[model samples]
Target: MRVLTSTLLVEAVTELSRGTRLVRAKEVLAWCDRNQVDCQGAGLKNQALWDADLEEAGGPHRLLKFKSGECKQSRVGWALIAHGAKAREAAAHLGWRELRWTGENWDWLGGEPPPPPRRPASREAPAQAAAVRG
Candidate 1:
């Protein structure tokens, strides 16, 4: 199985709808435990298993990114991408107060934009003197 890092998941979340994209880190771990897929087993439910600060999950690529906070969900915090809370980062950055969890199926929100800067008038023309001495 490919390692599931936040970076990769971030890209995945960008394209996938919240219904299909949201996968909590703990849920994944629990699934793995139920299936006995990894040798680490349920013991892998420790906090040190994740490293959100580095943009990579600790082991096997499972990771998460909470609201302006470090990964506390067993090192890998469970999360939903594009959800109101999760999408807040991107929405807020775009100056939008809210964003619908619609991935590719999104509509525009009335986000206020800053005004453009004004340039000062140039009183003098640019220097363009050419010498012709052949």
Candidate 2:
């Protein structure tokens, strides 16, 4: 069983159209929520995953189904969101927001948290920096 890595998912998502990408992303969020511990039928033994995820590296879109009564991540050092540590959780931790957005170039999730986008220096701060430099 090949573990569906985020890298693979990202690549798949990149291949999809913006509208379709969001649809898949929404499914991912739903999958995570449904599989949450507090939710019913939430356990490795009872949980089910999408067939596409297991087969085609479905990424985000595609109808989901259980592959029997349980599922497991094929990759080593991997765990499901229900158990703890999931792709969605990792995405959130890396600063992904659930907005109705669709863009091929937009980053859905990054393996690591990215640096904050640069902002123009404020007037006072710029002056202070210049004084120090001079």
lDDT of each: 0.36, 0.33
Task: Candidate 1: give its CA RMSD in angstroms.
Answer: 16.2
Error of 2 at 125 (Å): 65
> Can you write out model 2's per-residue Cα lDDT over 59-100, one digit (the tens) per residue?
443321111111132111122323223433543454333211
Q: In model 2, what is the error at residue 76, expressed in angstroms?
A: 25
- Give one digit per residue, the lDDT tens place, for model 1 in 9-127: 44443434344334444554554445443423133433222322134433332323332121232222233433646544553443333222233321223332222224675554332
Displacement of residue 15 (Cα, Å) in model 2 is 1.9
TM-score of each model, paired residue for residue: 0.27, 0.21
Deviation in angstroms for 18 in model 1?
A: 7.6
Q: Give me the candidate number with maximum lDDT.
A: 1
Compute the lDDT of residue 17 as modeled in candidate 2. 24
Measured with C-alpha atoms, the lDDT of residue 82 in candidate 2 is 33
